[model samples]
Target: MEKTTSLISKKHYPILDGLRGVAAIMVVAFHIFEAHATSHLNQIINHGYLAVDFFFLLSGFVISYAYDDRWSKMTVTDFFKIRLIRLQPMVIMGMIIGAVCFYFQDSVLWPTIHEVPIWKMLVVMIIGFTLIPVSLSMDIRGWQEMHPLNGPGWSLFFEYIGNILYALFVRKFSNTALAILVFLSGCLLIHLAVTSPNGDVIGGWSLEPTQLHIGFSRLLFPFFGGLLLHRIVKLTTINNGFFWASLLTVIVLAMPRIGGSKHLWMNGLYDSLSIIIIFPLIVFLGASGEVTGKYSTKICKFLGDISYPIYITHYPLIYIYTGWAVGSKPSFQEALPFALLTLIGAILLAYTCLKLYDEPVRLWLKQKMLTYKPAFITVK
Candidate 1:
């Protein structure tokens, strides 16, 4: 059989790599100017973190968009192998990084600034490595714990679990669309809890005080939306799927007290639906390559590329960097610059891992374990 095309190289979809750049920036901006109280940009920046939803959706869409057709031909082993290689190395590296930082400071928050206990340090490190947030605890796994570092990293647990399930049952379902929509509805339910009484979105969705552990149910849909949107776009072409729908959703978002506000329960899902629409809209436009070349170029994509590492590192660091009055926290003015500096630093570090560590380590493992069939190499 012909060697199947690999997912790694630029030839498959150049636009998405560029698009990844966009996602990274939105995340970064959320920490920097967007969420910065000094700039008073919180209206967008606070909400801008929602772009992480776009990333999740985009991941889902891209995964299914790339491989859904080949599901029957792919093996369970190959599926898992590729995912492990793609995810685990970064997770390990992030944990190591978090551990080292926690050790340096001894405490990440001011109240906790007296010092982080060795036991709390171990638990925080464990969460970072495992990617699962502490569930039943009142404080959640990564934050409010004694040592607590890297709150953003918790989402990966769900990402990994969801991918595994998709490989097993959901990926090849005849009613894939229905399944995705249903999953989306579940996320909407979680969204309802996170909704403020005033109707503004919360920093993160968790009906149960903190969504870290069990929040997986809600996060599942962003991934599903991307996957579903991918299929919808393939069926419809760029003609209508991504761009138009995304715009519509955003407009709907601006006036929260309107159409969606009434249904009100699934506000998280309602707003996230806009993300699915917006991401494709950006992709479709970027595919043209005309806009960024002329304008909208300086910040968005640059921030997007580094966004993940920034997101992973920021929250946990907040305690370390700021805090004088017991969880009063640092205002965005003081925190924003430090956040950006740290964000840029993380991107450089994560790149080194992606290039020097991740690829080499993955290649070595794949060669050692897998059958080495070219068709099985999803990320060549």
Candidate 2:
């Protein structure tokens, strides 16, 4: 039941693309509600953290499908260059947005923002533009995030690691080896998720070791699981794929917290099962089908297009919204309007960056950085 595409003619998995957009929006909602709760136990979008895992999974699958076969013409350098071209522009824009909104986010959460010199903040933003994680001592905003200005850049940081790993080594592994790697990583992921103090896989932003552990645990499994899934996929047709797949994605993400604090492992079990089992199924179904009608096609295409921009760009606004929510202590009913505005603002901002900055930068990079062909055929 696997869908086939010729090596020359790349197939578009619009449903997967749309599912990614669904996950991205779910992340925005999760962040919007995240400020109200002190812990993962009470967050309204209880499983929203899983969206990162979903994203890693999706990236693995898409990367494998897109590049696994192109090693002949493409070198590791070429691949990295292309990836930076595709992703780094938005990374820079997200950081810039954070800086632009920095003064406005001066709240209890970042009480010392007024004290942080603009030159220092600019230095951090410049480092962030390179996607480098800074130490806590150098953390200007005091959130301990690798990229304080744009929190989600941590995921993109690990994403770059995944890309480097794939380029250097993982791509050379046999399917059996990849499966073994996936298995070991899955066991570690399950252990980390289940045994977490908060009963979730909701970390990896800081430079500290524990956060690094949480981050890698979250990264390795779904990402390698996705790589393995792509390797062993048996795609089957699904009717109305865009709707059903998107629905399933939202439901999995928006589910209530699985286990209460007393039973943290219960939620851990849920998180592990969702990551290990359910997400791959969703990905399979998404890949099995295509968008049919003009509207569905357009919806999927637009969603897919804006998904990355929105996910990367929206979180800085979340920092602002979360700060406001925490400081003002408004009821959900009262804050709904601002939350809605934040959501709309994020979308508009991402779309604007996409049109005005990201697209042009990537086009220029493709022309200048990625135009040269590899001189030697060195397929490992």
Candidate 3:
């Protein structure tokens, strides 16, 4: 018997990375505009919430591409450790940022924030570190968010669930079985989308039953669909894939709401079709293309690096922005400067976190946890 190591770094899809960054930036913009909108139909980036669904699809494709074949040499523990190192550091940082900014966000939007005990907020932060969602009864803020300190953590919670399902059950699924699962999940997604009262697939940050249904409905189709796609689709070369895909993504997310007050389901149908059809097409294009020049490559790299940090950490700042907007009730022109500042601030903070915290922490964790050899292993 010979000792062996199972840690091998897989090549990433750069265009996919860039697309992710594009979507993350759009989410920040969406949230910033959310402060002024009276309802979903009138929001600046009406379909920006679809970015989460796109992310789920990307995760599925990437996970399958990276790990589906590695189980032959990797233990379940190894897979989990790898995921934690990659994802958990920023999660902790996001929660901390949210906690630090919590009191500053006290306003008409979150009336109880100023009065909430510091100990209770700390408790929420600690639980947030583990990604275990708090109950509504425990909500310190008036908003019924599962992770009130950091609302984006809800998507991450579902992300963890997808990973667990993969390691424990879905990884073993044959392409046929996975296809069936994807089909069923897709149906559920479509049903939920078209029938939703708001005519969009938006509310998944809460822990209540309806939101949970929205959560799982939003999670399963795109995730497993991406997995199934990776299993089935053959690669083809596409020129300037990043530019085209990024353009298409921004267009879809920035599109105005389809239906007005009387035709809400029209918007829901649009959401379903975009998630089911358009997003995967974007992923396919992104995965197939190569970065052509030094300039484009650098742009992709920067966007990829800062995408997750911007997404996970920026919402705390949004909390402050929302507080101000609600209290002051400023016109769009009056609010423009602050909104732009918030966007710039979110990008800068995300970049700082990426350089100072996420990269170093992940590197250290990988060295400690993933770089090891088994003593009694047979080399095949």
Q: Residue-wise lDDT of candidate 1 within 1-380, one digit each (tens)?
A: 44443433322333354455544545554444433243322244335555555566656766775668765556777778777776777677676766665566543333232344667657757765766555434242333432245555646665676688778877866556546565665556345534644343333433245444334534566677556665655332344222343343234433323234354435554455455455556644433332234333333334333444445545544434433212335665766566767566656765665667766887788777565233432221
Name the weakest run of 10 consecutive residues (lDDT summed) in model 3.
Answer: 371-380
Model 1 TM-score, all chains together: 0.70
lDDT scores of the candidates, listed in order:
0.52, 0.85, 0.90
lDDT of 3: 0.90
RMSD of every candidate to native, in Å, equals: 6.1, 4.9, 3.7
Q: Candidate 2 — worst ten consecutive residues by lDDT sum?
A: 371-380
How much is the lDDT of residue 136 in candidate 1? 36
Score residue 145 of candidate 1 by CA lDDT: 39
Please provide, for model 3 over 38-71, each residue's C-alpha lDDT reduced to its tens digit, 9 standing for 90 to 100: 9887999888999999999999998888778878
Best by TM-score: 3
The sequence of per-residue lDDT tens digits that candidate 2 reaches over residues 308-374 is 9999999889988988898899997999999999999988987899899988997788668765343
Off by over 4 Å in 1: 1-11, 33-44, 106-115, 135-147, 175-214, 235-270, 283-319, 322-340, 372-380
The local lDDT score (0 to 100) that residue 135 gets in candidate 1 is 47
Query: Residue 241 of model 2: what lDDT?
Result: 71
Best by lDDT: 3
